[model samples]
Target chain A: MLLEKLQSAVGAGVILPDGHETFVLNLGPQHPATHGVLRVKLTMDGEYILRAEPVPGYIHRMQEKMGENRSWSKYLPNTSRIDYLSAMTYTHAYVLVVERAAGIEVPPRAEYLRVITSELNRISSHLVWFGAFLLDLGGFTPLLYAFDDREKILDLLESVTGSRLTYCYYRFGGLCNDVDAEFLTGAREFVAYMRPRLAMYRQLVTDNIILRKRLEGIGRIDAELCRKYGATGPVIRGAGVANDVRRVEPYSVYPLLDFKIPVYSECDCMARYLVRMDEMEQSLRIVEQAIAQLPEGPVMGKVPRVVKVPAGDYYHAVEAARGRFAIRIVSDGKEIPYRIKLRTPSFSNLSLFEEASRGMMLPDALALMGSLDLVIPDIDR
Target chain B: MTPTLDELNQAFLRLLTPAPALGTACEMHDATSCEGKGVSPNPAPTPPPTSAPVPPCRIVEGKTKGYHFDADLAPDQIVPAGRLLDERGFAIDAVTGVDWLAAGQMEIVYDFYHPVSVLHVVLRCRVPREGAEVPTLSEVFPGANWHERETHDFFGIRFTGHPDLSPFLLPEDADYHPLRKDFTGAA
Candidate 1:
């Protein structure tokens, strides 16, 4: 009898016993580390997972339909809600789309400010991922240690932007407010303080032999599949595709600022982890450049208060911390958009995990998942 | 990246070959009080309205690009164009269906994001209050399966042939779609 263990419905009882000598196992939708509310039915033989089926849609919020009723400027705030961790980066992409749709021009100062906040948000997202990744692997202390620096970053962000977790800072044409002098000085201090501390994150767990054994070759995706699945950010970079939207499709103040995208040939867990860590460093460099070259000008663009973009279609994507976050707006020559859609990276990138998780042991599979850096709220929304 | 208003004004003027109906296009400088209802800052050619019935299309206005007719698609046109777009390397970003209860109509928009050209196409199809069904895009973009289901969950539009059209965001066996205008909040 091949019995299947129902992942979330423990009360409904496990599926018939695999009586296959091996056994079927129930993972979790409730278990703290399934990312968020995801239940998976795994057919296992002894310790190796034979077939791992991911049953998603547990958190599907019809995000697109809501955009239809709202006006273009109103849609900007929704971006931050989708990905709470990378709030600034998410809105950065969204504001660009709205600006393009409405034909608004942001000043040079606004662009630099956008870059600075966006990069800061990237680093912040990576830090949380780093801590959560280690925690998933069963380490507790690093979670606290990582948060120490993260708290400082969040405090800095909150001071200027107003919110900590879900920030809606970027305005349509430009930012909501110009960065004050004290805010800039504090940002510089935070960067200087965190630079050397990152070395500890590198040396402590990333370089450990046991961690390497778990991450090095567990879940391997070839370069070809990466492109096919439209994987972006560190995941695609792990597969050696040097397609960073900042470079390919320059938006905001990215063209004026200088930064490097790190890509590794190894399409495995270590490669992704290393890529994320290096990206944090690159983001720091962007912060420095923007701060040094911070220009003086208005923060908001000359966008109409009630933006009625002439009936047209406009698409814009920004390289967020996770991947390319895109917005597509179709206006019907009305106050509201005929249609609005968000192209999120997590949904596409995380879809690859089901294919990648087969054959690996349960622990190795968890490690591979940690490397993917999924923010399920974003996925669900 | 968006073309500046100035650049758009130029492009729109060029697109207007003969000239606008009002001799010149107007810009709704104060849109907050009024709809940017005026022609535009950029003068463009406005095709004279013909006796032909305006079926499923919207008026297209662009700052730089000339104003033209944008097809507000019918179900028949939507299915094929969706496949063509998916085949042409545009990834499905979202499948949205909006219900205008007061207006007695529902609009379904399939938002497609193409990476190569970095262009987004919003293909819209509307269904009457009686029968709202759009041929499935699930076969074309596998990612659309959940989206269509979600649309069904909200707007009450049936996406026939959707492999698993269960209530995704809502509870199991819930008769009403919470997103529908008629629905009275979370029941």
Candidate 2:
């Protein structure tokens, strides 16, 4: 029944033209390898995949429709839910767009604080991806170590934002509250503690021969493919483009601090893995610099209680853990938005999967998906 | 090395003018390399062309608007604009639709971003609310396939040449356009 359904839905393309038999396989909606409720229909001939059609929307929440109905301030919390793994960065994009459209001025201290918290959030998010990705590759040991390190970040963020996972901490022009001295000291200590662990991770997993063999030449997404598919974050960086929102777009206090954008030209799974691993260290550097340059002022900026965005469209983008998360708002000079569009990176990243995974072994395709570091809700949003 | 944002801005400005001949336009583009090398640093001595085919879209300050360039184009001009952006190494960012029920019109907005130069351009086209249609950009930017589909699912704006117009982020059997302001969730 499943084969019949898939064959009819996907059409004659599923059956090979040269009289070889092909079977349809559903990867998820319940499978653990998928990370969330994403379903990819694979038309397979023996071990090789003929086609990979990702059928997303099992977790679709119509978040954009909800945005139009909610008032400006009332809709802020929804941003955190878009991509729960890197919730702070999603919130950063939302708040930045709103602040920019309304012409609100954030304090220098608040900008620094935003940078510190978001970078820490980025580190924590990457750690989750590290563990989850290794777990996908059948390595249980790294998952434990990655999560153990990730817990420290969650604890530090929880102390300040009061939420570990989906933090609704950022406001229109600034943050909801200030980071205390204890939080600062904790962040500094965490950065110092994380550096050695990253090296340890490199020694333990990155240098493993079996792991390298599995990922090195698998899923070769060249620079032109990335451009055609709009792949970014570590994916494009892995293809030798030094494209980073912090460096290119220059948001927050990033220009005031210093960090390197890791680029690896291999355009394979290993290259993406290396780029992300290097990015964690860079994020930590940013966190440390932001803490050291932490200015003194109120965390929240002054503005009218109800933010009435001017009658126009506004766009803002930030580098999330997965890639570039952008938000577009069409306001009618009212408290309620006319339309809201959340351009989640995972959506664009996953869109390229079908084209990239064509003609690959099933296991290799899964490895490529793991390298993408997708959060399904972000795609379905 | 990649061209600076200023060079890209100049390349974009040059492409906006109506090409006198296809061969001549290609030669002019070849003369001003997409990379920073070989392109003149100074502005053109001649005044801007007044007889451009499409309405002029100016590159603005990134501060006032969140993006660098904003172009309001007719529905037919999107493909040409997308082709020029693709040639200049800009990636398709997002395709969004805004329903203007009061104005009885719908707006389809396409965003493009240059990975190296960090320039962002937004192209917007307004169509009538009923039977709204625009040319597909998927041929130019394959990345636009899903975005265009998602926009269609939300606003029911047809991309005439899109390969697949099926539901994205919506149930396969869904018939309602939920993002439209008039949609009230009634079965």
TM-score per candidate, chains pooled: 0.76, 0.90
Show where candidate 1 strays beyond 4 Å: A1-24, A50-77, A223-230, A332-339, B1-92, B98-141, B156-161, B178-186
TM-score for candidate 1, residues paired by index: 0.76
Q: Alpha-carbon error at A242 in model 2, in Å?
A: 0.7
What is each predicted model's overall lDDT from 0 to 1? 0.69, 0.85
lDDT of 2 at B62: 85
lDDT of candidate 1 at residue B152, scale 0 to 100: 83
- Residue A300 lDDT in candidate 1: 80
Model 2 vs. true fold: TM: 0.90
Residue-wise C-alpha lDDT for candidate 2, range A240-329, written one tens digit per residue? 998888888988888889899999999999999999999999999999888888878888889888899887788999999988899998
Interface RMSD of each: 6.3, 10.0
Measured against the native two-chain assembly using Cα atoms, what DockQ does each of the candidate structures obtain, in the order listed?
Answer: 0.12, 0.32
Q: Point out where model 2 deviates above 4 Å.
A: A1-15, B1-55
Per-prediction tally of clashes: 12, 0
* Window of ten residues with lowest summed lDDT in model 1 chain A: A1-10
CAPRI grade of model 2: acceptable
